[model samples]
Target: MADNVIELHPTSRSDLLARLRDELPPAWRGPRIGPDIPGWTDPPGGHIHDLVLTGLPEPLLTELAWMAHWQQVIDGSPASVQPLNQFAIAYRRACDAGHELATSIQQIDWETGESLLNWYYTTRWKRFPPANTRFRLRAVFHVPRLALIAHCHQGHWWELDEWHPRCDPRIPIGPREPHGGRIIPAHITQPWLREAVKWHLGTQLEAGTLRWSTIGQARQLTRFDRWITVAFDDPCDVLSDPLAAPAQAAEFRRWAADPVNRAMRSCDRRHRAHRVHPRQVNDDLRAVAELFAFVAANTRKARAVLGASPWSAVTALHADAWRRQITPIRHQPMLNADHYVDDHALAQITAALPLLALPRGQHMLVTRGDGTTVTAEGFGDPQVMRMILLQILTGRRASEVRLCEFDCLTPVPASTDDSEGKSLTRFRYAQSKIDIAPDTILVDDEVVAIIEDQRRWVRDRFPTTTTNYLFTARKSNLTATKPYAAGSYTRLLNKFSDLLAIRDSKGRPVTLGHTHRFRHTKLTRLAELGLPIKVLQRYAGHATPSMSMHYVAQREEHAEQAFIATAKFKADGTRIRFSRDDHDAMHLFDRADRILPHGWCMLPPLQSCDKGNACLTCSLFATDATHRDVLQHQLDDTTALIDRTTTEFASRHRRPMPDDNVWLAQRRAEQQALTRLLDTLPTEPGQAIQGHGCPTAVTEPVPLLPDPTFPRRTRP
Candidate 1:
């Protein structure tokens, strides 16, 4: 009975190394597990370590412990950290339950294994184990009814659960999810080629050269693999026959263009289903070509004949043919103003946010069309609502808002001009997709308060744990504490919309898609208000102004309106005459007469003049009382020349700027001359025009508008 009740204990480093070395194959076994095998080295000699190795089989447990490192050297890799941790949890539980190590390894079920993995993740570690480092397991869970599992390992926790059967050899189930979710090679008819491709992809995944996110590459390569299997009766003949490469590439082109093959079809996320798109066709062709290139370069037989890979040439030829044959697919632009939420719909969504965010027990009423109201409890947890609010206020992507940490919100220091002691609060968070560093946005006090409340909530809920995330879910019976899944807000937003009976201006039910529209709505509104392109670029986290423009609608109209408003043009259908006193008008110059009807010069005080008398095109040219008479006479002469040139060109039917017509060039030049003269000339007799409209010979330059759209910086 005492022997059956195995008191688990940590093994010494020397003893553990001896056991692991013994488990290694005959070729690998030595005085020490050293460099010949990839990861094994001198085990860190420590008396106080985390993992307790008692009641485990000598070979299997030893192998599992060194699995992460040895994966690189082995042909058939052992479990990665995620699945290894999961298997360890299950194996430990059986051993603790008085089952022998051998029986425990075989008895663990998927359901039980998965449950323990979630518990380890949410309750003990709160995140997955770190990669590329050796793991030292900590305390095992041995509480009654709850199975024993390894909780902490390495510096982080061993908690990320995976369904990879190959990770645990003791499991009887066949491997369903392959390494990195790659399509199984068994599906391909060519046995040897199938194995080769599988090994290549698996090695890439283990080496960290390829990621699970990029598993789509494996799917793409599989298309080519299937093609190879059919094209050559013997697929191995690809290495022997050099001609197979070009023949296969040509066949692929035909296959791609054939509508019958359905190679051109792909899933369109916009429609939420599969649809035909040419870009996807192009991607598929490129994927196959790249796979061929990779195989040719790496494979010994193919490389011996082909000096270098010929797939580049093959891909180029196919690309040209594809361009000629396929009608160009008109892609939906990344930024479409049509997708922008209407103001009325946005307003309703904004108004309902506060009510929806109200914590449980707080009552709110939704007014219906017939004037009857529905009493409703809070829409969701306060943190969920706070996340939505963050998206709206900061115009951040929904994912960015959801993944924010506890200290993401910080108060901006008071500005130099902020004598009233009021300062905007800054929201800072990570953008995982783009690898963008902490993006910071300054928001008003209302947003600041919401952030504070959310931070307090997360802190209160996770008082003891190091989970500083602003939003978190405790582990339930089956699920892990998911970092808010992408698009988590979409369903809740729709629910809130339904609850409020919200409708757009057209009387259509308003529907939100993935909360991205909030970003578009905010940016579109800013664009509509005529924010500068540079400012929009910064706000959108875009690399270029062109990328930012996708969010803006009616830019030309907005620009024209902004021009009229900011220039403060006179009403009554007449251009306002400038006086020397009106220096504010002179500062609006965006490089001279290309913009303003009356040209302006916004150059610094000490700048030297380059253009002597060419005031029309020169940005620095300013109108004055002294130049009025001279400008007026020039305008009269230029108008006469332009009229004569137009009459001559129309009567003769010559080109507008024919070789024989010096008058046309003269007329264009004089046309600018006339504008220059008119701008300097006063509309009213009493007013004197300086550059553009400098009244009273320019006294002092008015301060330019300090754009509020810019993220205002303040001292820390």
Candidate 2:
């Protein structure tokens, strides 16, 4: 192994100088010059000689000059040369003694990279932690030439511990921008297993199944990998052997379920027992299953790449057993009342929206953990308040609200005014989760105004930006290409809540960390307003009605109260008054069979309705003002049918059919029943017709047949 390891020698001064002179433009290689020099171009301005005179080692000097040149060209700013020179001096001495130093970043092997980085961090860049070292190394590796060489030679980016979005195109730039994209093979503790996992992840990336957003979830497989390393003397053997699967699977399940092996410990100060959340265990098992399944599916490819098809012998039974063992932790119910933001919290949050703004010459008082007060401009970007407002009004997902295009609003034509008096506008946003959902919805003037305000702010702030998004990221986004991060808005909202000390009705401090609650609140409010389910489905932008139904929480008591509040009437237009005892006995709201599309069944729950379409003419049938439109439509259709049938009969037999015909009689009876119901029921919903005398109990069951001569009195 020692013989195979490649040794790198530092570049000599003459060689390094020659390379730098050849690589850089002619204008850049001349005598030392400052920005004050006349006719000095920004990048090619003569500063290479000054860098050479810094007394730094040849390799470090050349790298720094190249970085300075690249920074001036890329970011229109020169690299900070003084601090890097001071650090490079120390680095040169360490290299001279053969201490913690690599000849070049490209030559640093993955196994020894961490120790070198730690040494640099602790001895030199102690002010910045390893996590934040990227900022410190910005001038060092941001150079395209160095980064490309490191990638091409070392088979990885210059940063061995993490991969940035620029490292791979598949890695998303937006989600974890500015910071590095994902932890790499160096993060794995076991060397033998690291390469295998790396290969597996690469395969998944090539297959287009793995996403950078979900990479954190995919990392859960490392726990299983670590367990395998401990369980088997030679973990590599288990990958190829068929019989090792069942035992491995069983042992992994036990290990993952154990509280001692839990990934995260309890942080509570009360010393609560650290229990492994079922979700964590399930995520681990799922990752393992996915890995094995992928290998099994692509056996030849897996063998060629990984040198072994891990879990190739895993059968359906083994998979089933693993799946069955997964702890069934039900997520918070979709219709959970607490999921929606109540009126108290919502009112407080809305009232505090103005405080989110950082007005010129004004400061917000912020109290730190130590009880000391300091003034801050405001929470975060003031645009977040408008984003929150949009969510509360539109019930859109956070992503949809945050990633809205600059031209998301289109003025609705005045001719299409269904909003009565208010102006309606069609608001458009990306429906990322559902591919088939409509991107545009009709919003009121208030929603339109909010979007318009955001548009104006964006235009004023980024006048020269070419990006089309309404909300652009404020940090590390020079070109304004990236969308406003969802996490940024969430943090801003939380800060706003804390600053204002917003509280709910119960006096507990309101934390709007989950902005989706605004969406839930909006949907729940719409549902409460008695909007038709299909219409609500469209408004929510759900692909299916069932998905929309999940947001509506109709409790049994509310349903019963609504049922009792609605005025009921029999087929002959006589009102059916229900006493308290009669309401209890009928169980009208509890029985599913009693509920109908256009009306309710007045018959007892024990009896089945034999009359199918005869509901309109049945004596026991009852309906209210809500079904008036349906009844009227039915009556008009029946009248049209009667006219068409009479004309057809006269044409076929050369004479009109007898008036006493059963079909004609039934049609006439239905028409009369519908007309009487529509006329008797008030047009306004929940309005009941006044009875002449004391209310009667609806205890007697009536026949299903129509009774034309029935008296116009309340049923008893």
Candidate 3:
């Protein structure tokens, strides 16, 4: 008998047995042991108890009793006797082999528990330990006393294997399930580094500097820890005196830049180079710099635990210099032409949306590219289809669409000045990325209807749920408290694309993996409609106009090319031909203010227009074939107004009004100008009314006023 082992007295054993008999059900009370003992079972139920504690070792019996008591209390039901049977078999094997036995659950560390599981599986079951072994150990470690002993409180931080962010009031709820809220600390191999990283992360959380869903930051630090281990003989020594390890730091730069050193994924084998993306390297370096800066700021307190500060002697200048030493990687620009979904693909996807409405756990029959039929799981939830439709209609980010609150739509108040009399709705969404962006945007009736339909579905599906989200996750979420995960939605969308065989204009398979493409496509369409950049910025919910400009800039370039390619007509129906120099000097596409509803104002960049809405009649205005419909509409509207005014005046005065009536004359002049513009435009579609045969040519170039100093060129 070891000193750590507790010897239960006969009276104590009798009390335990009596309590077990009282608490356990009849099926778990019958005696059955030896070769008849079964392996691990789910819902662990049967007719007989495989093992009894009547004649077991006192230490093993005491451990089993403690587990049984806690299990019953936690479950609020009669506890299973499976753990006793499993451990008893291991104990008997240890006795047969003359191996040391654990006195209690507290004495069983991870290695000792693993060996016990291995013996139980290999000898009795004749197989290797299954995945459930860790789960069983997790159950054992969750015992009240064991958990208290393992976890430590370190001033606003808990040092534990896992952290549940949802349980903490300081962390905001993210668009993920409660289980996804866990932040595991086991990935950081170095204990000291792990502690420091935990402290840094805790400080960020406390100060509200970290986004609740940002797990990549922690993963980036893990890469740094791995590099430190590989790059130095004693990582702790190097961390303690970072400035002194110049050579090691240089080596790290080389190691991080090498593609061979990068982690390999299953798909990477298809590529010949297997090169790590520069963006990943940049993220790793940036994370390391941030961690070092944080450690340097709190030298005294951090040093107490880490033995010495990681980068106390390093200054901001030193960190900046180190960052500059790495090769700069330019950000890959996202071009709208390359990323936006074309009309062909968008139409196909919209038509196939109904196919995604399969019920949960049911598979749909799909034809593969090889013509073989196979059953595959669809999105299952109709809300996912509605969510996709909302993304296309509203052009919102996937997070904003997926994490919408149950009551996100509200009717816009009718305004006295609204002449259109169209019903409007305002949609509110979470602006997760930009803090300064407004959450509400004006949406159309169609968008409102989609949202309302989703709301109805949520109500019918989860009648008892109290969650605020419109879209709820189905897995491991009995209460429907978790919003749909972004990753899961993306995976399902990819599957949908494959099942429907969605193809692009080029006949290649179109992947809807990047949901942001919908946003880009919407912004690009708005830009093509000649919406101002400032308005596009607000519509996009961007913090700055620059991001909106990125999408508009590409569309503007195409517009400019179209403008230059077609023939341009002045107010007097004179066709103007642009020499290369004339086109550069006019900067026709550069100024947003000069972009007219029906044409371009060919005014120089330096000039300003004082007459508003008079571009249609200005000599500087240039109209092409594309504006033929708009020019004809303006002419028709002007003629109708003039005739109506004349008739009303004649009726009031009992005679017809004269032609020179001041307002009437101006209206006549505008009407005449629009008629002439419409006549100059090509009647045939895709026809260029250039220098060939239609109107008198002003072939030389339009002259501009000279200036002593050059004016600033406006961006397109």
Total backbone collisions, model 1 = 12
The TM-score values for the models, in the order shown, are: 0.49, 0.63, 0.62
lDDT, candidate 1, at 664: 65
Can you write out model 1's per-residue Cα lDDT over 473-500, one digit (the tens) per residue? Answer: 4221011123444444566767776677
Cα lDDT of model 3 by residue, 523-628, tens digit: 8878766578788899999878878866543543344334544444334444444443344324565566666666666556787777566565454555556667
Model 1, C-alpha of 651: deviation from truth (Å): 76
Weakest 10 consecutive residues, lDDT, candidate 1? 139-148
lDDT of 2 at 324: 53
Q: Taking the tens digit of each residue's C-alpha lDDT, what string does model 2 give over 1-716? A: 57986666666646655775577554443323234333333332223323322444455455555555544444333444443443455566567657856445445433344444556666766753445444445435443334434333324232234455543444333332232334556556665456545666765655556655456533676666667668878775555544555666667877877765544334532333467677878888777666555555666655655463334454444444555556678776666665656656676667656657666467766543333555756554678888888888899888888887888888888988884777888988767565578888998878988888888887776676566678777654445556786667778777666666655545556577787767767787787667898889999999888888777664432333344454445565674454422442344747767666666666666777788867775645556566667777888899999999999999999988998999998888787766666666654344422210101212121122223354568557
lDDT-wise, the better of 1 and 3 is 3
Compare candidates 2 and 3 on lDDT and give the better one: 3
Model 1 quality (TM-score): 0.49
Give Cα-based local distance difference scores for all models. Answer: 0.50, 0.60, 0.62
lDDT of 1: 0.50
| Model 2 whole-model lDDT (C-alpha atoms) | 0.60
